[model samples]
Target: MTNETFRALVVEEVNEEIQAGVKACTLEDLSAGDTLIKTSYSGINYKDALATIKNGGVIRSYPMIPGVDAVGEVMETTSDSFKKGDKVVITGNGLGVSHTGGFSEIVRIPNEWVVKLPEGLTEKEAATIGTAGITAVESINELERNGLSDKKARILVTGATGGVGSIAIAMLKSLGYENITALSRKKNEDFLYALGATKVISLDEFMPEKIKPLQKQEYDFVLDTIGGKVLSAILPQINYGGAITLCGNASGIKLETTVLPFILRGIKMLGVDSVQLPNEKKEAIWERIANELDKERLSTIGAVEEPIDRIEEIVTHLLEGTHSGRTLIKM
Candidate 1:
């Protein structure tokens, strides 16, 4: 495979600008790693969309491949943990940020970053879950550990139309959670309902004229993907002893809330990060995701499938927030 070439979407600095397009690459062009994978499918993530734009702050280097999660089969390896023909999945761990990523027909990555595809999960299913699914599952896991045990708890998920929030809703429903509310900027009530949201609230309805330090308590648990004012407004409305798992900042990064919720309500706010988790933890969460999640409901999470060539258009839709659910890239 020395002289073999494959197609990849490369982001390079061209005359002080970021230019991304499909280009031919060789195995030699990839970074040295113990495992070489033939990518079957990859997912389009927010970070991957950002990495293509100029000064998006996702990629620190030019000529990078920007796919954060990939599901594929091992084609070659120098690591004892894996051998040729082994199916695997890779996500986070600097996959698309500091290293060459999954937007290619092939990817050579460190063996430590790889996880064997658990039984009962297809390549498309694994790729559909991708990084967004992992984040959603991890956030739920943290909430469960911190006292979100009531299956009938009133749960609210922000950014409901997005990948993480949609999957979170589906997973929660599959886990037997009764009441789930979705907050979205778009009018996709039916879409949210199909994903098991008991009710869908618009941003306008959710945000009032002003947010008080301690508003009426409503939610038992919140899977917050939109931070900034959304998070600020939500902090005061959490029921006493409830928990909130924050994993995204699509709104903004600032928080202007008082500590009354924490002091008086005894609520817990947990931050979930899927990117830097240890490989063993990732494997465990993935195993739970595979074993515990309903396959039919999980299958509904990925809404679109297109060849890798159509990535740029989907990226544009994702960046514009016009797209919903997950988009899979067939390689």
Candidate 2:
């Protein structure tokens, strides 16, 4: 691939607005780093899609590649952690946000951001899982911290139709958490059931007649991707000594609620930040996701492979909440 130019979805912000296009550049145009990778695949998350909007979604600067998750072979490396041709995966840790991300055929990132792609996961699969996998594993770890058990306590996953929600459900099922309830806006009940959801409730059904400070005891473990009233509503439903992991603020970051869930029910609210997780904990969680996560089931849940140039349209779908599952960008 010497002297060959490749396609990349480059986004530029003008007057505090975002503009995206299929920009072309040589490998030399990539940012300076320890390793240069020929990115085979990258995953499009909400952040990546936001980059194509009128302003920066995750990108801190304009004229930057916008992709948070990528996995490919090393083309060059200066660090001992990796050598040329080493296969690896990367995500989060300010990748698409503050760094020259993974939207192109080539990427340059610190060797510390690189980790050998875990056994049993392909470049495509790793991109499909992306930061969503890390957040799911981290959420479960928090659940375990609060004594999550399989002894009849129900587990509730909100935004069950989303990438993170889908993977979390499968992980819970693999861990023998069968009593799982899924809440989604989609009418595809069978899809949720197939993904190991014991019960599927439409968003309409989930809305309570009256959201009280506390409600009848319910879920022991909760993985929420949508924040706002949905999160506030779920708190009242959490069982005594239960735990909830807050991963995304997609619905809204502004939370207004009383502390009755903590004081009266003794519930634990854990925050998950896959983007800035400590390097050591991130590595441990990545290993767990690679080892314990069912590869077959992960693919079954969702993995859409589209050309990198189609990023403009994908962003609109994701922000509109019309997309489902993980969307992979084939570089």
Best by TM-score: 1
lDDT of each: 0.90, 0.82
lDDT tens digits, residues 210-311, model 1? Answer: 999999999999999979999999999999999999998878889999889999999999999999989999999889888888888776665588887899
The pairs that clash in candidate 1 are none
- Model 2 is weakest, by summed lDDT over 10 consecutive residues, at 53-62
TM-score of predicted structure 1: 0.97
**Cα RMSD to native, each candidate?**
1.1, 1.7
Q: What tens-digit string does per-residue lDDT give for candidate 2 at 176-287?
A: 7869899887856777787788999988888887788888888888999888888988998898889999998777777767899999889999998888777788778878
User: In candidate 2, which residue ranges exceed 4 Å CA deviation?
Assistant: 1-3, 55-57
Q: Give the top-scoring candidate (lDDT).
A: 1
Over 4 Å off, model 1: none
User: Which whole-number lDDT from 0 to 100 does residue 268 have in model 1?
Assistant: 98
Q: How close is candidate 2 to the true structure, as a TM-score?
A: 0.95
